[model samples]
Target: MHLPPKQGAAFDPLSEAFARDPYPAYAALRATAQPVYYAPFDIWLLSRYADVQAAALNPLSLRSLDHLMSADEMAEERRAQNWHDMPFHARFVQFSMLNADGEVHQRLRKLVFREFTPGQIERLKTGVATYVGGLFDRLGGPFDFIEDLAAHVPGLAIGRFLGVPDEDCPQLRGWSDDIVQYFDIDRTDARKALAERTTKTFYDYLTDLSKHRRRHPKDDLISRLIARWDTGELSEDEYISTCMLILMAGHGSTIDALGNGLTALLRFPDQRLMLSADRTLMPTAIQEMFRYDAPLPFFHRYASEDMEINGWELPKSTKIGLLYGSANRDPEAFADADTFDITRTPNRHLAFAAGPHFCLGNHLARLNMEAVFSQLLDRYPRIEPVTEPVFKPGLSLRGPKSLPIAVR
Candidate 1:
């Protein structure tokens, strides 16, 4: 049965209401019999867990259309999507491993695979804890959790992993934010120019740092990657872009996860109290938080050939939007899905996504959450929100923009 995809007439992802709470709209999307065709992005949205996981695991579904589209076609498409005219972003941000598929993605991923494994990420635990403890010590009374605490943690943790100087992490966070904001729905000229300019500035900084690492090789990711470049394993562009991706991938997302996780705890006091009473639940609580509100929610996939998803036919080159956030909340996929429960077992959420393109820095992201929340629980016996947190408006990211809290 070749049924037509449902029209997503009521799905307005850019609306302020969606920004405040998208789960209701997501629920509507999931209730449809077939995938919904959202004309705004010309992409079919898959909200169900089964449909999304199947598409992600399917070899025909790709992150990039370059394999199926001609150069001219790609150029035109880029312009159509407002992704053209940015040189540095095109070179690095646009062409990075996140957008690559097949062997290229595998090769790029392989280069850094060992560095991000659970064991490798475990080594970073001490550094993350020490830094987080210092931040907690500096806090007094009511403070903006996102700005004062959450924002500062990821940059230092990921910066240390990539061998970035502690002083430079803050600037790198700003650069990452500007570059990533353009990836969302708003592609205004100002945002494009800002993304481009920031990329160039970021590129130059990495280039200089790479040079220094080459001369005085240290025991860090950059120094190690430098050896690979010297051995002709990585091109200059590849080397620089790889470093940029590592930093950008983990920076804001981790920060957002922290903020979202804290908000979840504050909202569900019982769950918070459960985890607080039983510290063993911290790890599970962290996982529940990511499942509850995935930071990087919306990602797209392109079908390289005709495919039938749950009996609905999708033609080649059809853009399929994977709503990971929605999938995480689907009632069919999770019992009591909407309820925030720290003790939920057998949780198989798609927060880090799945299949080949699963987030490489997932372990590190989880570790940061555990460290911060564990330290927070230990430090503050009582924590309350001073003001209600407002989520950033966009379909691409999810998190409280600023969360004011009082700790005693």
Candidate 2:
């Protein structure tokens, strides 16, 4: 199986123009290439909404952990960068949910699902509301919402929920930022050093916390994982990996969602007013935000076997990239795809992904957004954009690094 021959030049996913704004390029690809497009990036891309959704749902054809670097390559990269051989980072390939498949994925997911249940998130709503209220009350004049409000709210909530000390929240935030910065396409030595240091610091802290939890069990998720570790249900390394995954995914994605959501709302005043007037629209608005500007633009998967998709033959062991941001805006699936309409019905966006690898923290993220926006609208009835939103430069996660806003 092969894609239909292109009438024109094949789409290049790595071009500077496409990197800057991929929607138009995706549109062109969808028009010219089949649903699956073989691009110059050594990967096939699923551009259409249907194709992307199907790929996400089909685990046999698509596997996340398979796309990551091999153990040898990962080790070589670490040594090349002069980074420490920490157990945490060393086993990152084996320890992360993104690197797991089949039964292994199911088991790790079950542990996380038990901890981050709907009830647990519902119980967290009040805390989120309180934190948002306090942050809103303290803000004066113009401030970067991403840094000042959006970023801190989720970090604080995650820290409190994880039973991490309040003092450690700031450090965790720094580590998250460093990790993100390290993933920047144009990384520098200084940035790499900072990321390594931050990662090591976090590993040290979590390692100690794991020991403490073993001695003094608590009701938190970390303690639960530690309990499983003791019973041989979960390995020691797995426990630490789970904690890191929660901390990073819990805060990192929410931070991006809030910042991006707020920017979208401010950019579209009519939508904002519509949502503010009727709070019922908040949920839909959050969904639209995820669709409009997904926290993660794309996620990687690898083809485990030779597969034919939309007339294209995907060879076994081939890496495939799904562009969620592009797929969300596919004109075939979304009416007026470019516009920001909060009350969009049947908004089945792939922002949280699909199938087994679906985000376990989706509920928490939505709850956080709803709580933050509820308090934000009530407290600052006259909130307005103070500065142009600045998007963080990364092909993976799409979010504003800085979003300045003023509340009167």
**Clash count of each predicted structure:** 0, 0
Clashing residue pairs in candidate 1, if any?
none
Off by over 4 Å in 2: 3-21, 62-87, 180-194
Tell me how far the alpha carbon of residue 367 in candidate 1 is from the true structure, in angstroms, after superposition: 1.2
Q: Residue 256 in candidate 1 has what lDDT?
A: 93
lDDT of 2 by residue, 257-365 (tens): 9988997888899998888899989889999999998888777677777766555677677667888888898999999998999989999888998877888888888
Q: What C-alpha lDDT does candidate 1 achieve relative to the native structure?
A: 0.89
Candidate topping lDDT? 1
Model 2 TM-score (2 dp): 0.89
lDDT per residue as tens, model 1, 1-408: 453645645788888899899999889878866555564667788888888888888889999999889999999999998999999999999988899999989998999999999999999999889999999899988999999999998899889999998898888789999999999878899999999999999999998888887888888899999999889988888888899999999899998999999999999988888888999998789889999999999899998999877776778998989899999998988999999999888898888988999999999998899989998898888889998889999888999999999988
The residue ranges of model 1 lying beyond 4 angstroms of the native Cα positions read 1-9
